[model samples]
Target: MNTTQELTLFDNESEVELFKHKITLEKIKNELINFGLTSNQSKVFIYLGKYGSKTASEIAKALQLPRTETYHLVNSLQNMGLVTAELSHPTKYTSLEMKKAIATLVKQEQQRIEYLAGKEESLSQMWNELPFFVVETDESKSEKMQLLHGLAAITNKIKEMVGSSTENIRVFGSMADVLRLYHSDVFDWIDNAPTELKMVISPMTKKPEFVSDLDQDKIRSLVSGSDKKCFVINDSKEILIFMRNANHPTRQTFAWWSDSETLVEMMSMLFDLSWEKGEMV
Candidate 1:
C-alpha cells in the first residue's frame, strides 16, 4: 500500500485499540465501584495500578482532578489499605495489587455486615422500648400532600412508601430516575418489600444491571416515544411525581407526593396505560 493508505490503516487500528482500552477501563472502574469504591476512587486506584507509583500532584494532573480532592482520595484509599503512601521527598502513592485490593474491600464489607448484624438485636430492643402514639384528628382523614426537597428527603420518602406498601407498587419514569433510586438503596427496600412491583422505563435508555435481578415479568421498557416524566404509584393510594428538571443536579431536585384520591387515581391510570404499552424486559 501507498504511504498515505498505510498511515490511514494505522490510524484506524489505533482508534480501534483506543476504543477497546476505554471499554476495558470502564469495566474495571465499574467492578471497582461494585467492590465499594466510589467512582473517583476507582479511577484513582486504576490509575495507580496501571501507572505504578505516582506523587499526589502527578495523580491529580493525570486524572484532571482537583488537587485537594486527589489528596483526600489518596488519604482515604490509604486508610482503607487499598493504597499506600511512601515517606519520600514528595510523598508518593501506590495502589495495592488488584487481587489484594478486592480482598481488602471484601473483608471490610464483611466486617461492616457482621457489625450491623450483631447490633440488630440491641437496636430492635431499644427501638421497641420507645413508645409510639398517634393522635387521631379530622385532619388525619383528609387528603395530604408533601413537597420533598433534596435527594435525601426524596430517598427517605420513597423508602417509607416502599416499606409501607402492601398490595402493589408501580414505577414509571426515565432511566435516570430509576438509576437514582437504585443508588439510594430504594431498590433494596423494594426487593425486601412484601408488595408486588411493576416498573416501566423509557425506551431509549439501556437496561441497568439491577434489572436482571428483578422479576422480568414485572419490569418493562416503553416501546413508544420517551419523556423525562417520572412517578411512583403505591397501592393505588398515593403518588410521588418528580418535579425537578432532569438535567439539574441532585441537590436541586424535588418531588411532589400526595395521598389525594383524585391525584392518585390520575397517576394510577397513567401508570396502567404506560405498563400496557411497555415491552417486556
Candidate 2:
C-alpha cells in the first residue's frame, strides 16, 4: 500500500479503537454507578484506574471538573474504599483493584441489606403501635369532596376504591381514559376484585384487548359519542371524577373524589342510563 493508503487505513483503525474504548468506558461507568458510585465519582475512579495515581489537580484538569469538586469526589471514593491516597508532599489518588473494589462494594451492600432486614420487625411493631383515630361530630356526618392532583394520587384513590368496594363498581370514560387505567395497572386490581364491575366506553373507541381478561358481559360500548370525562363509582356511595382531560399527561391530570350522597346518586343514575344504552362487548 502507498503512504496515503496506509495513513487512511491507520486512521480508520484508530477510529474503530477509539469507539471501542468509549463503549468500554461507558460500560464501566454504568457498572460503577450500579455498585453505588455517583457519576463524577465513577469518572474519577475510572480515570485513576486507567492512568494510575493522579493528583487532584491533574484529575480535575483532565476531567474538566472543578478543583474543589475533584477533592470532594476523591474523599468520597476513599470513604467507599474505592480509592486510596499515597502519602506524599502532594497526595496522589489511586483506585482500588477492579476485582477487590467490586467485592468491597458488594460486601458493603450486603451488610446494608442485612441491617435493614434486622430493623424491619421493630419498624413494623413501632408502626403498628401508632394509633389512628378520627373524631366524629355533626360536621363529620356531612358529605365530603377531595381534589386529587397528579397520576399518583389518582392511582392510589382508584386502588383504595377498588379495594373497598364489596358490592358493585361502575366506570365510564373514553378510550384514553380506559387506557390510563389499564396502563396504571388498575385493571389488574379490578380483575382480582370480587366486586361486580360494569364498564362503559365511548362509541368512538374500539374495544381494547385488555377487556378480554374481564367479563365480556360486564363490558359495553356507548351507543353515541361522548366527551373525555371519566369517573368511577364504588358501591353507589363514593365517586371519583376526572376533572381535566383524561388524555392529558400524568402531571397535568386532575381528579375530584366525593362521598356526597346526592352527587353519588346522580352519577350512579347517569351511569345506569349510559349502561342501558351501551352495546355488550
Candidate 3:
C-alpha cells in the first residue's frame, strides 16, 4: 500500500511479518539427533506445517530435493510417527497431529530433567565425602617468614585467621607502633571483625576511648602483642608475626597458617590469664 516510499520494510508491517516467518522456520528445523532424519524430512515437516499436505512428487519439486532422497526422508519420518500417509488418489504425506508430537516432546524433556537432577545429587554426595587436603611446602623458615608485610598484608592475615572463626586470636601490637597507622586500614578491619579478637597492646592504650568500637567493646587486653615484635597467633597452625616495628613501612612480617593445636593453646592460655588482670575503658 505504501509503494511510494521505495518499499523498504524496516518501519512497517512487512518487517514484522518477515521476523515472524524467520522465527517459525527456526522452530521447525528440528535436527534433534544425528544418524536420524535427513534434511528433506525436516523440510517436509516444515512444509506441511506451513503449506499443509502435499504428494511426494509435489514435495520433491517444492523442496528441490532429488525424488529418491525425498522418498527416503518421507519413509524415515513415517517410521518416527512424525509423518503419516493420507490415503488419497496419489497419496499425500502429512506431519503427525501437533498435539501428539508435543506430548512426545514433553515426555523427552521430563526424562532429561530427571537425569540431570540425579547426576547433581550424585556429584554433591561425592563432594561431601571428599576429605580435607593440605598441599605440602619445603620452603626454608627465613623465606616463609618473609612473606607477611605492611598494613595490607598484616590485616589480610588477621581476617583469614580470625574472620568468622569461633576461636580466640592473639593480636600483639606495640601501642606507639600503631598510633597514626591505627585507623588507616587495620582499624577498619577490626570494626567489622568476624570472630573473637584478643588484643595484646603495648601498655600504651590505658584508655578505651582511643580504639575502634569493635576492639573497645569486644577486645580482651593484655601485655605481649605484635608491637615489640608484632605477632598474631591463632590456634598454632596460623601465626602472623612482624619482622620489625611499625616506624618504617618497609619492615616485612610473617604469617604461618599452621594446624598446631599445642602452640595455639599455649598462646591462648597466656592471653586469657593476662586478660583477667586487664581493664576496659
Candidate 4:
C-alpha cells in the first residue's frame, strides 16, 4: 500500500515486536506483585512464565539485573512453590501453572491458622503472665483497683477473679447476663474450681435452663426486686462490678475490678444483705 510502509526493513519490524512484548511483560509483572511476589521475584517469574524456561544468566541479562540477584530471586520463587529449577548444566527455572501456584499459597495460609489454633492455650497463658504496665501511686498491689472496658476485658477479669477465689464467689445480675456467661462455658470453669457460688437474679428476668443444673444449696433468686446491674465478689480478695443500662437503645455496658480490701468489704456487706432477702433455689 504505502511506499514507506512497504520499505520497512526486517530490523525495524523486529524492534516494534520487542517493544510490544515489553509492554505485555510489565502488565504481567504487576499482576504477579498483587499475587504476593516481590518486585524482582515477580519479574523473574513472569519471564519464566512467558518465555517457557530460562537460565539464571539469561534472565539476569534480559531483565538487566545482576546475575547474583537473579539467582536469589529464582531461589525465593522456588521456595514459594511458584517456580521449579532443574539440576542441569547452567540450570533452568520454570514457573508453575498460575492456578497451582495460587493453590499452594492458600494451603500455606490454612496451615498457619491450624498452627495458631493449636497454640492458643499456651499463648493465652503466656499473655496473661506478662505484667500490666500501670502507672499508679505508692500503694500495696493488693489494694489496687483497675477500670475494665470492652466485653473481652470484663470477661477475662471475671475469670481471673473466679479462679483466684479461696472461699466463696457471689454473683448478682439479670437472667440475660447469666445466660451469656452460661453459654460461654463460664459455669464450667466455676463448677471445676474449688469455690462456692451464690447468684442473685433480678425479679424482672426469668431463670435460665442451666439454673436447675447449678448447686441448689449455693444458688438464690431475688424475690423482692433487683436491678440490671451485675457484680461479683470473690471472697474478701477482689470485687468486679458491671454497670449497665439494659433498656437503653444503645445497650451500653461498662465494668470495674478492684482488689482493694476497703472497697471489697463494702461490696461484701451489700452482698450479705441481698443474700438474706434472696429465695434459696
Candidate 2 — which residues are off by over 4 angstroms? Answer: 1-135
Please give the ranking of all candidate structures by lDDT, highest first, separated by commas: 2, 1, 4, 3
Candidate 3 lDDT, 206-267, residue by residue in tens:
64456654546555555434345455666445565565556454324334444445655666
Q: Report clash pairs, candidate 1.
A: none
Q: What tens digits encode model 4's per-residue C-alpha lDDT throughout 1-281?
A: 23332222112355344454555666666666656688888877766776678899878877678999998999999889889989888899999987887788788768887999999999999999999998775653446778876565677788887788778888877776677667757778788889888887765346566798988778777755655677888988888887652332121456778787888899888878777887876
Using Cα atoms with residue i matched to residue i, what is each candidate's TM-score against the true structure?
0.52, 0.56, 0.39, 0.50
Error of 3 at 41 (Å): 74
State how far residue 150 of model 4 sits from its true place (Å). Answer: 2.0
Each model's lDDT comes to 0.82, 0.84, 0.60, 0.74
Ten contiguous residues with the weakest lDDT in model 2:
3-12
TM-score-sorted candidate list, best first: 2, 1, 4, 3
Angstrom error of the Cα, residue 99, model 4: value is 23
**Which candidate number has the best TM-score?**
2
Model 2 per-residue lDDT tens digits across residues 172-225 = 998888888888998789778888888888854566677787888988887568
Scored against the true structure, residue 26 in model 2 reaches a CA lDDT of 75
Looking at model 2, residue 276 earns an lDDT score of 86
Provide C-alpha RMSD values for all models, in order.
9.3, 9.3, 19.5, 14.8
lDDT of 3 at 171: 68
